[model samples]
Target: MNRARHHRRARAFPLAMLLAACAVAPPVSARVQPADAPADATKASVASEIRAGVSGKLKDFYGPRGYWPLWVEKDAIGPQADALLALIASVDVDGLAPRDYDPRGLQRLIEEADASPTPKALARADLALSKAFAALVADMRRPARGIGMRYLDPEVEPRDPDPSGLLRAAAVTPSLTDYIQTAGWMSPFYMRLRTARADYRARWGDLPGITVPEGVKLRPGGNTPEIALLRHRLGLAQGAAYDRALAARVRAFQSDHGLAADGIAGGQTISALNRGPAYYDQQLALNMERARLLPGPWVRHVVVDAASARLWYYSKGALDGTMKVVAGARESQTPMMAGMIRYATLNPYWNIPPDLVQSRVAPKILKGASLKGMHYEALADWSANPAPLAQSEVDWGSVAAGRSEVRVRQLPGGDNAMGRVKFMFPNDLGIYLHDTPSRDLFAKPARHFSNGCVRLEDAQRLGRWFFGKQPVADGSAPEQHQPLPQPVPVYLTYLTAVPTAQGVQFLPDVYGRDGD
Candidate 1:
């Protein structure tokens, strides 16, 4: 071969080597990108999917939008999308927005998926929503007919709405259950729905308080906010077929939770009851913990679903007894833990927490001086009265009182504020389950009251069980406040999802604690 031909052959050989290397070399780039590079992927795709489905839903439910789904792109969907996306960011979900998230070269999260709570819940919610919609679509299939059909059932009986069960259904499913088991649904929207529903049922159902307020339109499944306020005020969401039984029970609950005993669903009564479902779930989780505590041959014991604002004393695997109780007010949430009541207190002292004294009690004493109603003792001097300023001495005749350093306390007795007796199951919170002189509060459909203690109904019966009452009334009550050899340990817990009393009852969450 000539010199020129040899040179050409060498050049061709080098080109062939370059091609081979390109084909076999391992990749060095660790960035995540689409086969088709960036182009408003997150916003465009997610919005397209959500809007297409959600728009149809809004149109179908509210009728041609009727000015409801109007401006959905710029107005409606935008806000919801932003909230959902912000939540996604909080969960550290992949592809969170660049404006707020950093594009760090971290390996993709694997089973660590188990550790992150928010993402797990969001994923569960998305899956459940998808599954439920699919089921509904299947339920209302075409049958080889035309387009979609079946509007919201107007003929459907307008009973109290119950969405907690809906949420429970989704959470209990094997796939979504993981989220339920760990974090649980606690968004403020859920609480709003829960409390709003309970409020209407308690207020609107009353006959005497029935002036039919505006915005009180009754829906098919649950009560509206206006409806709840009405029923709660009217004393209408009265009772079921067991009114007689419940009335006596209501009186008992009122006595237990510190409400007036008028057998009416007044503000106090409603406040003492209508807690949302989150509270009860806490109760369930705690009970599950208690179940864990008694790993031995534990047959019978009284269980207080404090978060559910109810109690069950069991013997021989049956509900031998039950009670209606009011739990901690929103500010002083009940603690979560386990304990056993070795005894019950006949009369109890209402120790005022420093926060309550400084915030609420002081303001009330300064303004209207209503200590007689709640049986409060204006502490003339908590710390030796550095300059004791009781409401009496501070001449309310002239003074902007929201600023005064007022302190108060209530002694224990029949009207001693804690009522006749208290069931003890001590926990770290310094909170307990007890009785109250004001018993009417339990009549309302919802309950959220007290600084952070639980008031019990038929305390004497609760007393009986702890005292070793024989035959432990399986369906009635264990026994009323009776003889006690030693003090019983009482635990005041905060739980909202409960499955007792009337079987899976939902409560109102007045304290606005869904954020927690």
Candidate 2:
């Protein structure tokens, strides 16, 4: 029951921040009907507002075919419009603000219609509602700040989900909401987390904070006064005893939060248990934002969950295997990006990055003391086409002093940094997945030791899968490159929570990238 106590204000969204409000509508002069407003007036206002302020891609989509009202039938709000409003209101379930999608002027129109209003107001409402509906669908389909906010899918350009097409289909379809929901590519993990959040907010959200001593450690079959507080905090009924049931609950909580499920309440597990409802809610919110950037299902792919330092392989959209990984350290964080693995290289050489050379290797090797099993190369220049210089011809002091540019490369050998192979997915960031000789580091609970690239423990297996043949394990003299039978997409993502058999397992944010 020991939990950190902090009050968090509920996030506020101003109605003025609604994007639909920025649109300009056509002037309506005559009285309009709710069920059968003037078709021409509705069309004019809807097209003008959408084209003027919705989004460039959407605007271009409708512009080619005269701005027709997508969600209006008989000059009134159609079934599609009704379903859209319902979905917008419940967007909060997905950690999005419903106010962001509220249709401008729709409320006023509803009031006026009740009070026997004129036709022009009704026409204005219909048009505004249609435009707002279009904007909402667009937002729901992409990242919050648009696709540009995403670092993972940088190459995934923002292609507008043609709202006009969706509206047309939804108009004739009875299951409009269900059809629209299909467009979102939310994973099972996200859906489960959403369910967990809703359940937490409903039951124990208002419970009084309970404190557990920081140094207290409780094992199974051990009795302490804090057991009562723990039962109450965990929603157990009063008069509960510190028995096997209490131990089971503790183990479940630890497993869900990525702690060792030993049924022992230690300081780390206590801290995780101590997190209040708001903390969980905020984590879910931030993760939802990260999920928005992810691409949809792929038949076969690789995913690196940077937060957990794990690599997952999927076949036919199902997770087939996984392995431990070493991600970037805190100062040099692994970035979120997506690319296609086109090839693999066996006996790959490690061309040391200049920054690492200047900061680490140069400082140690400058004293002219050769390190064990270390190979240093002096280059004519730091450029890609640098000429090689023999070890005896180069002055180590001058290279260390920055007076001369030297290229430091470790040749392919038993002790090479890139153990036996490296997977290449060409990207501007100079990051890739490769093997590391320091395989023992992967056994650590937190594996954030790499400079920036991802180090894989199962590089040989991955190589075999990609190349359709086993890689040379002996670190042969010449490096060999083989293209994959077919390119497989790789997503380097940062997801902290994933649904497991036990529950939603929340991994530690090794990179400290989770803003919450």
Q: What is the per-residue lDDT of model 2 for residues 1-516, given as tens digits with 9 covering 90 to 100? A: 112222222122234423342253323422246643345444454455455545544454455445444544433444444555656666676756877765334655544433432233434454556556666656655656621232333345447767665344333444444544543334433455666566556654665457655678877776677777777766666643677887887787776666789988889977776786567667766676666555443336787877789887766334667899999988888887777887887787788877776666666776554533377566767576678776656665665676755677887777888888889888777789998889799889888888889999888888877766885644365467877888887878788876565555677777777765
**Candidate 1 structure quality by residue, lDDT tens digits, 1-516:** 001110001111233433432332211221124642222222222223333344333323322212112111211121222332223333211112332322121101111212331222222323333333223222211122221111122321122323333333332333342332221232221222233334333432232432334422232234345444534433545422323443454454355333556554445554445433334334333333322222111135444444467766544323467778776666665544445554455545566776666666656656666666776655555563335344566533222344444455575545666666666554556666676777887775555576667677666677667675531222322223433564433323333433332233334445443334
lDDT, residue 3, model 2:
20
Clashing pairs in 2: 3-274, 31-119, 32-119
Counted clashes in each candidate structure: 65, 3
RMSD of 1: 23.6
Worst 10 residues of 1 by lDDT: 1-10
Q: Give per-model TM-scores.
A: 0.35, 0.63
Instruction: Judging by lDDT against the true structure, name the best candidate.
Output: 2
- Residue 263 local lDDT, model 1: 56
Q: Output the number of the TM-score-best candidate.
A: 2
Candidate 1 steric clashes: 65
| Candidate 1 CA-lDDT value | 0.40
